[model samples]
Target: MQKLLIIDDNDEVRRQLKWGLSKGGYELTFARDGVEGLNMFKKQEPSVVTLDLGLPPHENGVEEGLRCLGEMLRINPLSKIIVITGNEEHGAALKAVQGGAYDYYKKPIDLNELKIIIDRAMYLQTLEQENQDLRDSSVADCGIVGECGTMQEVFTLIDRVAASDVPVLITGESGTGKELVARAIHAKGPRADKDMVCINCGAIPENLLESELFGHEKGAFTGANRTVKGKVEYAEKGTLFLDEIGEMPMSLQVKLLRFLQEMVITRVGGRRDIEVDVRIIAATNVDIQEAMQNGTFREDLFYRIGVVNIVLPPLRDRGADIALLANYFLKRVSAGAGSRGKAFSPEALEYINGYDWPGNIRELENRVKRAVIMATGPQIEPDDLGINGGDVLRQRLHANDLSLKEARMLLERDMVEDALKRESGNIVKAAASIGVSRPTFYDLMKKHGVRNA
Candidate 1:
């Protein structure tokens, strides 16, 4: 059933529409003002909306109506809005249509004539919604979920770089979806139809990593009973994703550099060089610059595979996307389990917004999954997320007790402690982990009463 939302200030007009539109194959809903209308629009996602040009505090003016029109279109561009204006204000109706309303009608409303407009609006809304769904499907095909500025820039870079078979280096915190970005780059590019072979440099043993990446001939080693093709050959004319590339040993780095330069790989213990065409997309959680300085990673190899660089921002920095991703995951997980839909409690949202997600989006998603399974009630509380809910609840009670500066100091102190813990109390490593220099980390430790030693 199609939904029709009527936003008008006049009570009698709404009564007439409720009486008239009730029989027109529609689920009719009414809003007295702009606020109610927007709230309903967001919740119901109505197909068509009938909006009055004179609404609320500005009953004689079109200011509030225009604002509502803009917000409605921003929220759901596919919604069909029919602007209802006074006969004398035909110009305002035209302005509303120009501002994104589908169409407009002037003067006293005739139930029969307005019904035709409403039905037509519903038909057009259906068409627009279908087109919008197709567009969303295209974005979803890439499997990257983000609308933040940084991610937007990364998407733009991928669009530009994907057309060419170039080497791309994606660097971010461990759980920031680097592999997803790599897949998106390949999937959106010309090589999407071919295989995308992945090799985790850090996961495989150093001795086997070479065989895994560059194949092994029969009887090359004890396990090499048969000639095995490697990731490079398997991904011929496709993509080769090297996850945790920073963990590639220096010896393997030399081989990788040569492969990139020559576009050929020699099997272990085999003198024959096999030429293979593959696009390289490498990712690492660690700071490559720091690794290169520490002599663990090669600078030349970095330059070779880093023709295009995309850095994914951690979840904490993405702000509102936390809620967006949370809701997205909630719907997906709940649908998979055939479970009743549940929402996050208000306090849970507060904790979600305040707590820094050190493990990034993966942690957030894992916690949400746990909450879905473990939550005893309809609402998933901070406790359900398994991140010190009692502390968050207590902090909420005493939120007004701390001044802004005091809160900032307390959060900063905790951050320093966490960084130190994560880095095993190595101040230099801890500083680097949090994107700060050693001296600045020492100052923070000192100010927070944390022992540098």
Candidate 2:
């Protein structure tokens, strides 16, 4: 049953509302004045409140009633408030609506009509509460799974910066959960109620990247048939997350910087500038400083985006987070797939902990997902994960002892060898396939002393 609170100074009015609502399948509470009603509202947190403009001290006065409503909303903005006033006070009731009341009622309350209004308020309030609960629940889901000092510091940073609108630059290795941190930030921010737009800067070609960010007018380009609103525009009063921002082209960087400074943008091929209010959070796997030095990235844009910086630790550096994350992923994937519960075997946990996750949390998630799908028994084993196969150093270690340096070298060598083999000894193709530039790939080859095949 919904809880309904009625506040009115008239003895007969309060008694009648309580009797009618109680019979209408509601748990009703009454307050004889604005002050008493506010106290009850704080204590009960009722789903719907019927507020009376008239009270003992300021009977039928709009001033005290508006104050009470404002205070109630401050405490719980979701509270459905319906203002009650006299037929002569109809103007005051309209003022109440302007002041944020959900609905208003006039003198000589019809028991049946009033009940119907309160019922609707109760239903709407229930829906809003459920929506807010789901949003809060999502924040808990995005929490970083780790006990390491580095992860704890990251958590602290997230909590400290989530309430502000400052631009956040997250730098970390691929698969280190930069996007997760971004989501946590959005989920806790003032704009949590709005949408969060995530764009992958490296995925789009340079020609289309600007159009994607600033939108395009119809016929702006060959493929443009319809006028489109870009991610930045769509995320008004919300957050826009630019992932892999280091890959954003220099030309687009200037436009982006202009937008950040002016809080506005001109659509592609359009003359008018549209204003947008949005918070930006960017992330990248590459060294932005190196990109800046190479003239591939703009130095001015770098300082503009990195107002607050958060560096996520790799999964290998997070120690026991490996197993914690594994179990968390297993449970989620199992539940999502509607399969029976699955768990990791002792041997599997040992192998997971021993592994230096070059791909970080992302690789760990993939391994766990694959194990859950392939496992014939309830417990996933070391062999279920492809990492434990071949001559991987992690497979050679005992559960209690593992070497990080050897694991990293073995992982890097395996990646380079696989990329080279896949590309048939084409250096450019190999580098692109492994997400590195040709020059970087050549340096890695020299560092590892691997001659070109």
**Each candidate's lDDT (Cα)?**
0.84, 0.83
lDDT of 2 by residue, 224-310 (tens): 999999999999999999999999988889999999999999999899999999999999999998998899989889899998999
TM-score of each: 0.62, 0.57
- Best lDDT goes to which candidate? 1
Q: For residues 20-60, what per-residue lDDT tens digits would candidate 1 score against the true structure?
A: 88999999899999999899999999999999989998999
Write out the backbone clash pairs for model 1. Answer: none
**Model 1: residue 37 alpha-carbon error in angstroms:** 19
- Tell me the alpha-carbon RMSD of every candidate: 14.8, 18.5
How big is the positional error of residue 199 in model 1, measured in Å on the Cα after superposition?
0.5
lDDT of 1: 0.84
Which window of ten consecutive residues has the lowest lDDT sum in model 2?
388-397
Candidate 2, which segments miss by more than 4 Å at Cα? Answer: 1-141, 337-340, 394-453
Candidate 1 versus the native: TM-score?
A: 0.62
Number of clashing pairs, model 1? 0
